[model samples]
Structure formats: C-alpha cells, structure tokens
Target: MEISMSTIAFGFIGFKATDFAAWDSLDYISKHRDQGEWTGLYIAEDEATAKGYLSDKINNSGNGIAYLHKVSVIRPGKLITCLDQSFKTGNIDIPALKQAMRDKGINVEDTDKLTEKLGQLGYYFRCFNNEDGAIEMIIPVELVTNVDMQLYKTCIAKSFVFSCQ
Candidate 1:
C-alpha cells in the first residue's frame, strides 16, 4: 500500500507505566508474564498532537506487527520491549526497522525468545501502531520477576503495564 507522508508521520503513544483509573482501562492481572494479558500500566497519549497522529496511523493500516532483526540494541544498559513480533532468528541478531508500512495482522510473539540470545538485555514496555494507531506490548523475560515487586506478584493477571490484550 502507498503511504502518504501524513499517514507515516502519525502514531500513538504508550505510557507504559501510567494508569487511567478514570477510564477503567487498567486490567487486574498480577503477573507480567501471564499469557494474553498486559502486565504493566500504560497510559494513552490523548493530546491533540498525539491523538491526531495516531488517528492517521489507524486509518492507514490493518494491524501492527513487531519485528526484531537488529542485534545492535542487544548490548547492555538498555531495555527492549516487544511491541510486535515478526522475524526469523537464531541468535536473534534481528533486523533493522523497515520503513513503516500498512499495518498487517498483529503477530503473536513471546518475550522469552527475544531475551534468549542476549548478554545483558532487560525487558521493558514497548509501543507501536496497531488498530487506532496503537499496538500492544509486553515485558521480556528478564523483567518478569522483579525482586522488589515479589510481594504483589499474586495480584491477579492484569497489569496493563506490559503484556498481551
């Protein structure tokens, strides 16, 4: 599909650690590693600029898929979250982000696979464009069990901070 400059420029924001109790958007999941649940708190950027840009992203595509074909970011001191998953791998050197294209069906990806080949990579919240110019995100295995958050691990399976839909 041909993407106009306006469409390409549009995108949504994922406030991974933010929560919106007013909107009732937060889930009740306890574990970040649980299946099909977002494990972190994420805020939607509703500012006019963000909302407008994101609107374009939503209309210009079908679904969003994450691709990890680049290993350059695999080094230490950085956290990589899986916003989408669509790539071939071994040691997961991964691929560079391709030019933004029409959204496709959201890919079902596991966080463990990406973290399996790294030396020092911690998982974190990721953001991308899916329907409505927003994509889903999840924490990698490295960030699954935090030493400090162990007490509240049994909260449920809804964290919205990072996980699946």
Candidate 2:
C-alpha cells in the first residue's frame, strides 16, 4: 500500500465498470474508452486505483459499484506532497518538504495540516494499495468547488487501503 499527501491539477468525469460482466465486456469497455482521453467507463487495474477511483465516484455519484462521477487528475508539479512507496527509502522526505515550505514562509505545521488546508482549496487526497503491498498517497491541488472535507474523511475511513489518520 502507498501513503502520502499531495495536490492534483485536473478532474475527469466518467463511468466506471463494476462487475465481471463489465470487466470482461470488451465491447462495453471499448465504447467507453473511445469517448475521450479520460472519459467513459473503465475497469480499475488494481485495488488501489479502484479505491481511489471509487471514493471519488461515490463522492460524486454516491455509488461504489459501476457509476459515473468526477475524478481528480495529478500531474508532476501539481502534487504538494507525495509519499511514494516505489521511491528508494530516504530519497524523498516529507519533513524536508515541510521545512522547505516553512523556509518559503508557508505556515505548515506538518504534512497533515498542510494537506487539510489544501483539501479545503479544491485539492483531494487519495491513497492506493495493491494486493502486492504497493501503496501510494496523492493529494491533487485541483479546482474542486464546494469542497467536502467530511466526504473525503469518510472516504478515507472506508478505503481498504491505509488510512490517513
């Protein structure tokens, strides 16, 4: 599983496959895939992506199975903080980032507070963990309107992946 906090840039709205029928149905998948770059329906490749995508889906659609909803998009520089399990140990440090932010006169007590504040500003948090123990945390600083901190908290609580708190 992966855990961290950061920001994202854009959000995508579309349908997602929910069952074996939807998963195995090439025609259905193809049709949705043809809609746009990140539009239509999609089958999550792993538990992490599914959890992240589903949480966003539920927040937007109130359904976890197959549904249409808005999902955040993260690019390289858009992330405020990223805790990636794939990175070599000690390569990227959260504390260092915090210090850097503080050095730049950004009032950041810690990563959690920083992320929480960012969340209020249209950024959403995502945690993903595959069955293989791979985990990642992402906080996308996108333009989310009427930000729902409670919904995000609930989503994190229900996520099968690691919890933020």
Candidate 3:
C-alpha cells in the first residue's frame, strides 16, 4: 500500500498492525492468517478510493482472500471498514505461527497454509453460516506492513481532499 505524505494523512501509524484500531478485522480473513501475524494492516482512512485500493491490493497480492471487506459509511462521514470471510480447515498450531511475517514475507502459499492451520485450531472451523457462529482470532500489529497500509490511506485521503469529483 502507498500514501501521499503531503495529504490529510492520519492513520494507525505503527511498525506493527496490532497497533491499528482495525487490527481485529484480520480475523475475517481467517483467525489463523494472523497466527503468523500476517493479517493486520488492512484498515482504510475514510476514503472510498483508499478502501478500494487496499482491497484490490490484498486480493491481487496472493492473499487469496476468503473474506469480503465491508466499508460502512456513517451519516457523519466516518467509514467503518470490516472484513469477513469463510474458513478452510487445516493445521492451526504450526511452529511457523509463533510470530508475524516480515515485509514481503506473506504469500499465497502461506495464506492457504494458514487456512489449514485455522481448521486444525478449531476456531476457524467453528464459524457457522446462517447461525451466527463466533470466531475468535487475534491480529497483532506485527503482521503486515503498517507503513504501506498507512501510505495508501494517506494518498487516498490527500487525493480526496484535493479532488473536486
């Protein structure tokens, strides 16, 4: 993700995705995707373009998204972005899940493997459709590049501030 520094840029700036208010949104992808701490850094900064950009990036970047992100725009003009998805069953407690991945550390293979692990963990497997199933996953800030996500948000924020259309 990239953002313009010369804009009305304000994001959950941190080295880790756990620091973001939207950190919990990662669970929607798969509770265990973040097990390796690879799920955070998906928040948007109240701009439709920004949210759309990140969504495209996450989908195209080999994440192979299972959950769909919902961008809720309030009457006061605040965008409440939420991401949710279905889980695939697999191994959940691999040693690789001990910490988060580094920059460019995430891949399609990793995400697929994580889905397997979530199934193994039972948390992801428990998500029931049409019955309001509960899935519990923790998204620490150490997963994805908070800087990149913030940059995207900032750029879109700036562009929105300046654009007439």
Number of the top-ranking candidate, with lDDT as the measure: 2
Top model by TM-score, which number? Answer: 2
- 1-165 per-residue lDDT for model 2 (tens digits): 233444343343222313221122244434443232113222232334544553443334343333222232422323333335433353445566557556645555563544544434443333223435443433322222222111122233233332422
- Cα-based lDDT for every prediction: 0.27, 0.36, 0.27
Q: Candidate 2 overall Cα lDDT vs. reference? A: 0.36
All models, RMSD in angstroms: 15.5, 14.4, 17.1
Stretches off by above 4 angstroms in model 1 are 1-30, 34-120, 135-137, 141-165
* Local lDDT at 147 for model 1: 11
TM-score, structure 2 vs. true? 0.31
Question: On residues 18-104, what C-alpha lDDT tens digit does candidate 1 reach at each position?
Answer: 112122212233433343333342333332212323222222343322111101111223333333433212122233221222132
TM-score versus the correct structure, for each prediction: 0.25, 0.31, 0.19
What is the C-alpha lDDT profile of model 3 across 1-165, one tens digit per residue?
Answer: 210111112233222212123424344445434344233323322233233343332333434222223222111111111122322233233333322221223222443544334233321111111113322222223322212322122211231232212
Report, for all candidates in order, the number of backbone clashes.
Answer: 21, 12, 18
- Model 3 has an lDDT value of 0.27
